[model samples]
Target: MATQAPVKTISPEEYLAQEELATERHEYIKGEVRLMSGGTPKHNDLSGNLFVAFKLALKKQPYKVYHVDQRLWIPSQQIFTYPDVMVASKPLVMQEGRKDTILNACLVAEVLSPSTKNYDRSEKFQYYRSISGFQEYLLIEQEQIFVEHYVKVEAKKWSLTEYTEIEDVIKLESIDCEIALADVYEDIEQ
Candidate 1:
């Protein structure tokens, strides 16, 4: 029988130093870092649509909507991630000495990819819950018109609402925004 070498974990500092120069982005958890996977066209479209929807709805509010380019830092979990769509309160708490990463995200949305749907639904969701004001989560399927919405109803508790039809609408209580399934699936094939 052959034995394989154990996986090595790098410190968060080392990961950030390398990320500064790398072309592709990476996610950091505790002391481990992993390169993030690329998204499909459908994934990109959904992310952009959701961002625009939230941005327009909260234009005059004290909230900011971030697209894929923004990084989120969960201090309690020691995790750094790039949410597909993040709606954070104004005066975003930035990681000390860093401007691109924010410390608070009231709502995080991810467009489900076949390779990452499971992680996004489980571990990733768990990480998001650790943030102080993190309250809503949206997992959107790229292969179908299905969405799983999780709302934080109480401390350590959450309620789920799923949407399947294109006419369905999600009223995000966390951020006080409404998004239609049709708008999210607009121009998206399959």
Candidate 2:
């Protein structure tokens, strides 16, 4: 029998160091790296709409809103992925020796894509929940005016509310921000 060599997995520190110099974005999970897929127009629009709404709603407040390109690290899960929209109510927590990675986020939003919807809702969400500071999660469907809002009710417990009508409003309890369904799907044709 022939023996095969074991694959080399990079450490989180090594991944962060290389991530800074790499041109394209990649996510790290469990010592392995995965390339992020490109988003569609609807996806971009939804992300932008929510970002603008959150930015406007939380203006002049202590909360900070971050859109794409801001990497979030879940220390407990050792997963590094970029959220479509993120909100921090307190000072931004930076990963030691790195500015691109954050450790604390009260709110995280992801616009669902057909290619990643399953991963986002299951594994990805489980990873996000590992963060002690995560309070609310927004899962938006790009194909329809539907949203699944998950709020942390207690440790390891959550409440889910679904919104389907354009008139529906989602209350982001973590940052005291409210977003109307119409505002969320604005400028995007069905």
Candidate 3:
């Protein structure tokens, strides 16, 4: 016979306290605190490349480009998560007491790793759509030259665009930025 303790959910307040002092990043969903695992080098490279591309493109603009560390708060879902890359032109709206958590995003991107690819394409995409200013979602594969781009066309409707060729240029509607897949996968292995 075996006995297991019931799982417990912590308040977002408690999670925030621990997150501030903890070395690792965590996602707060509803009332649960889930630790975020580290990504592979390939994943890191793609994220870095994407961030660099956005930074260079919006250098003089008023937009803010964020990499993995900046957290996003989805009020509708009561969740806190970090996107691989995010570009925002809307006015900055910080989570009530946090400078690192933002409430606005025009584009949110995720570097898809094997373990998270399915989730990122489904549940995570749904969560991202809840952002007030969110319009475009980018899902980039770390193991291949594939990107699934989604642009919101209407309420509850989004148009899908897929790119598989290295020469493909991803036009981000919300941010009015274009990035090449070759640049994103630069120096990274398949």
Model 2, residue pairs in steric clash: none
Residue-level lDDT for 88 in candidate 1: 91
Model 2: runs farther than 4 Å from truth?
1-8
Per-residue lDDT of model 1, residues 1-190, tens digit only: 9999877888767887888898999999987888899998889999998888888889899999999979898888889889999999988899999987899899999999888999999999999999989999999999899999999999999999999999999999977878999989999998
Clashes of each: 0, 0, 0
Report the C-alpha lDDT of model 3 over 1-190, residue by residue, as the tens digit: 8989866788778887888898999898888888887998889999999999999988888799999999888989989898999987747888897877898888989998777889899988989998878899999987789999999999999999999999999998877779999899999887
True-structure Cα RMSD, model 2: 2.0
What is the Å distance of residue 91 in model 1 from its true position? 1.0
Off by more than 4 A, model 1? none
| RMSD of each predicted structure | 1.0, 2.0, 1.5
Model 2, 1-190: lDDT tens digits are 9999876679999998889898988999989988899999989999999999999999999988999889999988888999999987668898888877888988899999999999999999999999888899999999888999999999989999999999999988888878999999998888
Deviation from native of the Cα of residue 80 in model 3, angstroms: 0.7
lDDT, residue 112, model 3 = 87
Query: Worst ten-residue run, lDDT, model 3?
Result: 88-97
Q: Which candidate number would show the highest TM-score if scored against the true structure? A: 1
